[model samples]
Target: MNKIATIDTRLWQLGIMAILLLLGVLKRDFSLLPSQIALTFISGLLTQTLFIKFLNIKKYSFLSTIITCFGLCLLLRSANLWVHPVVAYLAIASKFTLRPFGKHLFNPANLGVILGISFFPETWITSGQWGADLTTALWLIAAGFFVARNAQRLDITAYFLMCYAGIFIIIRILWYGYPLAVFFHQFQNGALLLFAFFMISDPMTIPHKRIGRFIHAILVAVLAYIWQYWLYWNQGIIWGLFFATFLVPLWNILFLAPAYQWQPLSGDSNV
Candidate 1:
């Protein structure tokens, strides 16, 4: 592999997220406002800096902060400007405060999405913002595969997608006799793929061992299935991951493995 291929995966994640944000703004794929995006970044980065300074902590990179802000910009929208920054502040703080056994309990951005919708009436997620565009979905998958493969957490993404898809197929297609088009349409959803590849596959927040990851994936899929199909709620995958997070520490207790760390880049640029 080349230097780029061997580089830290967070860099890849940052690149992909930046691209998506740019596309969202330039192509009008989403309804993100410039002020909202600006405030989100400011709040998240400032929070990360305060924690690092106050705690005198090392072994940190701002890549995660940037990525979380991008996630907020992409997934969250608000009528009021203050909601973005408030959620960003809380989301970044969660990374510092919510560590269990040295790993953050929730993916910061995932928690941000949950907090935005649950607490703030002005904030909401428009899942269909990207539509069911085939080209966009393929682009996301191809880019996401590279990042996941580099992080060595592609297995989680695959397991989650497989479990989620199987449940969808069984319930929607076989049980309800929905057409194949409906199944295909559901699979093409950009939000679903984003949750699978980006949110659930965050190596830092999830279980450490393969078996634990496998079980986590299935549990999340089941919760998502139930939340969406049975309760008819939105952002089921986000909620599913949140609910499934309770068992992560148990799995870590049972299946011991090294906690993940972002690698130094090819040029040792991991400050």
Candidate 2:
């Protein structure tokens, strides 16, 4: 396979931008395009300089900018809040401020959402938590499966989902009366599916080893469930991802160190 086609780092980004746009359109959050475009340009420029470092046609840059705009639109629409452009600028700026070398500790969008929700209460921002209906839940589940397959992380996803569901179920059985409808509603609500598939699976920030990834993913799931149901934390996914981002990398390093120091077996050589 040609490396360029397969390894064009921008392709996944482009795909994600398109996804964000489609989400915006479906949810009718067209107004956020400008900010999304601006953010996309910054993301592209920084990612290209650090990772791909490739110079493409001018049109590509333009399209990339548009992608950011569309994403911002989706984000703002989803939030259903009225944050100013300055706030958006601050959110994007924080991405760089929070990570000096551009290795973001958490998803920028997740961070921005949480910051907006927590510190900027005056912004009047509400997430399109409204768009989170039964149909969207079904779609999110399908997308989650596909994303997990692409990342070769279906095992992790399964472990995480099972842990989350199991904990919630046990909690209901043991303490709270499990309202079946609300229980299911939680799964189908907000951008939980999006976080599970896309944000949580960011390769740069997640564990690489199979076992490590599984354990890390399970932890994320358990933590997410606790935050959402037990704590009633609104930005539950962000909290989960933020912790997973730091902890999973450490877990991978610790687990892999033992293997790295061990000599390979006579017949079975593996890292």
Candidate 3:
């Protein structure tokens, strides 16, 4: 019997994200022009290539760079063309420069989005851009499930979602006496689902051990809840993840596990 082939999880994620980007652009009006998207890919890949050559890394994998570009296309918005490429370049650059204990400190796409929004006021994420439609929410959840499952970090996604939802229920529905519809409305945000599944569930940035991942997920949920609800802030998940990243090294120290590699046994396994 011929053995079935396994697709690289990064490719699976890339395909899924590409579909999401197409849907966002076609149906949701994601506010990005084709030129901007093209520029982002060009700059990101070019930067990745330069880094690999400069650093003398033997393995050349563009999957992560493509994935990061897709993420930037989906989540980031800016009026200027330069903004996308600059952010993309910085995002890829962080992966090389920000390593500690043999691992990248921040999720590339997350870091890019956070930095874009922070440095340039015009660039921001539209959490509700996908709308409150149940159909859209279901579509994201289904696609995200496969990606998370393939990455073997579905547990982190589940824990984060459950904790985030639990906090929403207690604070908004029960304590504040908001209508059930309000809770459901918030639950159906496509951006929230995207963050939970794609961004936070990134194996490279997440804790290696199961227990550490669980704790990390819960911490992000609580911090995000407080940031969005109590502090009346926008892009709560992005900021929450940013601040929570400070604790990841600590978690790794407390509970050691092998660093994640996109492809095992490859010469260039780090990507």
RMSD of each: 2.0, 8.2, 1.9
Q: After superposition, how far is residue 264 of candidate 1 from its true place, in Å?
A: 1.0
Question: Between the candidate structures 1 and 3, which one is better when assessed by TM-score?
Answer: 1
Q: Rate the local accuracy (lDDT) of all candidates.
A: 0.86, 0.52, 0.86
Instruction: Quote the positional error of residue 154 for candidate 1 in Å.
Output: 2.5
After superposition, candidate 3 runs with Cα above 4 Å error: 1-5, 264-268
Better candidate by TM-score, 2 or 3: 3
Summarize candidate 2's per-residue lDDT along 42-65 as a digit string, tens digits.
654455333322423121222322
Off by over 4 Å in 2: 1-17, 26-104, 115-130, 257-271
Residue 213 of model 3 has an lDDT of 90
Q: Estimate each model's TM-score.
A: 0.95, 0.65, 0.95
Error of 1 at 117 (Å): 0.3
By summed lDDT, the worst window of 10 consecutive residues in model 2 runs over 262-271
Best candidate per TM-score, number? 1
